[model samples]
Target: MSKTDHPHTHQTHAAIIKRLKRAEGHLRSIVAMIENERACVDIAQQLHAVEKAVCQAKRTLIQDHIDHCLEDSVGALGRGERVPLDEFKQITKYL
Candidate 1:
């Protein structure tokens, strides 16, 4: 079934939002640091933190979507059908 037909909420939605917000804060600080002519190493460290936070948030959100969609729609893991190998690979590209 299409997503619209099986509408459901992610269990990790709140945690994901929190992570994104933290990343946003780091990004804004990075901008301010640039404006203040901070050291390159310091700025790079903060940038790395932002990158990790965003990556983690994206991974969590996508994994949650995959898990819930499979379970709710296709009877994944516990049932006979599993998420298609191609579909799983497609999503992993982003991660």
Candidate 2:
């Protein structure tokens, strides 16, 4: 079953939100810096920080989904049924 088929909560949700909010704030400041004609180096640094924050948030979200949702998807399968577990590793390859 898909995650959308059921309602559930994730422990990492709050932390992800916090990270996104911080990235949003950094993005806003980056915009202001551009409007103020800040140096390219300074703007690039802020952009890097925002990018890293967003990437980290995404990684945390995906990992949480793998940890919880995948387990739910797999249910009580036999030990030899390792495809879903293999998918857990495959999903992280994108990160």
Candidate 3:
């Protein structure tokens, strides 16, 4: 989706990108730390940050799917537009 749709869209995208960029830096630092044999605590914290970033991205994707995909599905079904009910049901099942 375009960034102009809704505030949630832009905000979520921004959060996701920022998290990934930070995680990228963290990954580089992780490699350096590994080479230097840094403390395990610091490494673990960086790993957790990566995990959180992944989850945040997942949540944002799910939100967009719900907002756009489900909305389109519902509208199509309501209008009896040619979208097969069984197929739509399967699609909605994922949501």
Candidate 4:
């Protein structure tokens, strides 16, 4: 299924987009700093910030996907409908 088809209703997709855009801006600033021969320390600091922002966005997206899609979808498996162990293990890879 397409990404949008996933059940992420509880998480605001716009918030994720905003975060990614912010990270993209930070990355652009870093590139400019490098081209200008900015101080190594200053460049490193900004790079770190950009990395953290991207990582946070990734973590948020994965958590939201698991919380809304995996949990909700698997929950529909009624009584006696066993979820495969392999499927559960695969899903946990994100965590």
Q: Please tell me which predicted candidate would have the highest lDDT against the true structure.
A: 2
lDDT of 4 at 45: 99
lDDT per residue for candidate 1 within 1-95, as digits (tens), equals 74233445788999999999989998999999999999999999999999999889998988897886654545454455444444565667886
Better structure of 1 and 2 per TM-score: 2
TM-score of each: 0.73, 0.75, 0.63, 0.71
Top TM-score hit:
2
- Quote the positional error of residue 14 for candidate 1 in Å: 0.3
For model 2, the superposed segments whose C-alpha errors exceed 4 Å read 1-6, 76-94
Candidate 4: how many backbone clashes? 0
In TM-score terms, candidate 2 sits at 0.75
Question: Which wins on TM-score, candidate 1 or candidate 4?
Answer: 1
lDDT of 4: 0.72
Alpha carbon lDDT of residue 79, candidate 2?
Answer: 55
Ranking by TM-score: 2, 1, 4, 3
**Higher-lDDT candidate of 3 and 4:** 4
Q: Write model 3 residue lDDT over 1-95, tens digit each, in one string.
A: 44223333444677778877888888888889889999999998988888777777767766765665666667777998655445445445544
Candidate 1 achieves a global lDDT of 0.78
| lDDT at residue 8 of model 3 (Cα atoms) | 37
Give the CA lDDT, 0 to 100, for residue 67 in model 2: 76
